[model samples]
Target: MPQKATAKFIVIEGLEGAGKSSAIALVRDFIEKHTGKAPVCTREPGGTPLAEKIRDLVKVADASDPLCDESECLLLYAARAQLVARVIKPALAEGSWVLGDRHNLSSLAYQGGGRGLMPLVSAVSAATLGDFKPDLTLYLDIEPSLGLTRAANRGELDRIEQQELAFFERTRATYLSLAQQDDSIAVIDASQSMAEVHKDILAVLQTKDW
Candidate 1:
């Protein structure tokens, strides 16, 4: 019999409407097919009970008591710390591949680039996660305007999703810049049709030896 596949951490990242949900489904199915076992799926700022509360705090804002950038960044790390320690680490230890909806990369892009808190984000990430990172990240690239349009079509926009267009522009710029610097990140043009996008994603999975 073939040896069981090694545990791996794979994350899907993108703008609000970059088709991340679909991408995640595909990746989850692919991992199950290859490993003959379902991977443990998780989402950042979530995955755990305490982290879910943090997620609500981050996504829902009170106009009277707005969430400042520094506070937002710290809260994200708090959620991340909980998720990593409680969910991700344990699942990985048990030799189960972990599939994540979002990870540290989202903070680097949204909080670091969108909110201009890279210094604080970097520090928090270092302290919270140390050297932990996804084995592979699939970044779905899409124009901010188009992405927002898609998001709006889906439902009411969240607090972060309600940000000005310039915010998303900054976030996208950061994502592209970071992807260029990291080979573990693969950029997929999410502007393509679903068929095309899935094809590209499959290509990445098949080609990358990870």
Candidate 2:
């Protein structure tokens, strides 16, 4: 499993409307500016055709055949497996750093914490990913209410985003808890002004050897 000498997998994680898109863009530019190498960007439950299909299934609401919690979790993993094997792994092996919009942390927060399926999520993750994980994870922390408001302003709510506020609260709590335990995970206050948030992100990246 030897990888490219300078390849690094960096993932941006957060709740809905936590400004992950902008954060990813910032990280991408930062990496290119600092390292002089463009990163291969990806998104969880996507990054490939098959994975993109799975993403749609996971995001869209179905009335007659509603997606169960277990099904949702498994579907996400299925998509992840596809992306990791077909895209992320190959890119990394080819000397390309990967900048991701979201990764396994999303499932840990959304399914494990929100759906109260931590045990299942942990087991599935251990089985699927083995020791593979992002070298650096930038977690943007935002209040659920505030995040949801932003999401609504953006457009129609997806099935997942349509979840109750309590669900997002649980998800946020889990995100913070995990960040506390993992030094590789950097927590950023997404509630700040965009400029302030970008400044904090830059400060974090500066500390890295990149």
Candidate 3:
């Protein structure tokens, strides 16, 4: 038989309280059912050792010594570069599926829409990895306020998580716009109950349709 194609890179994206953690588990099981191989799960800014440290560095920022938005954007790209080169690429080469908690789209939504830095985000992504994208992206859409409420209940908010509700609205808008243009993205109504959301996600996964 001819050699099989590499397993796809699947990414899960959403606001803090959009049930991404639980959704990823569902995605993992879905991919395994189809491919008979367990997927590798990785979180942005902290897949590897150095990337984890970067995650910590970017997570907390003092109000007295806040990080510049531009610098914050660059650090995110740096960590992404490390994770992509170190983890994602290798896994795909070995033909194992990869499940990403967040990928390049997060930067576009958060740093671009929220921080008003789309140009910088675009330039960084193009320079670091031109035209590289996940095979499929599942965007869980939810109201910003509801999502924040879920996140707040989880634990203390991170630096970016502490942003005002307006910031998240802009971010969600950007994510929706991107999904509208990309066929590979499946947008799930995350505001629904867990069972409904999971069912929608499974439908997309089984059909391979957005």
Best by TM-score: 1
* Per-residue C-alpha lDDT of model 1 across residues 36-141, encoded as one tens digit per residue: 7889999977988999999999999799999998998999999999999999999998989899999999999999999999999998999988999999999999
What does candidate 3's lDDT look like per residue over 28-75, in tens digits?
888777777788899997899988888887898867878889988999
Residue 123 in candidate 2 has what lDDT? 94
TM-score of 2: 0.97
lDDT of all predictions: 0.92, 0.92, 0.90
Which runs of model 3 end up more than 4 angstroms from their true locations?
Answer: 1-4
Q: In lDDT terms, how accurate is model 1?
A: 0.92
Residue 100 accuracy (lDDT) in model 3? 98
Q: Is candidate 2 or candidate 3 better by lDDT?
A: 2
* Pairs of residues at least 3 apart in sequence or in different chains that clash in candidate 2: none
Runs off by more than 4 Å, candidate 1: 1-5
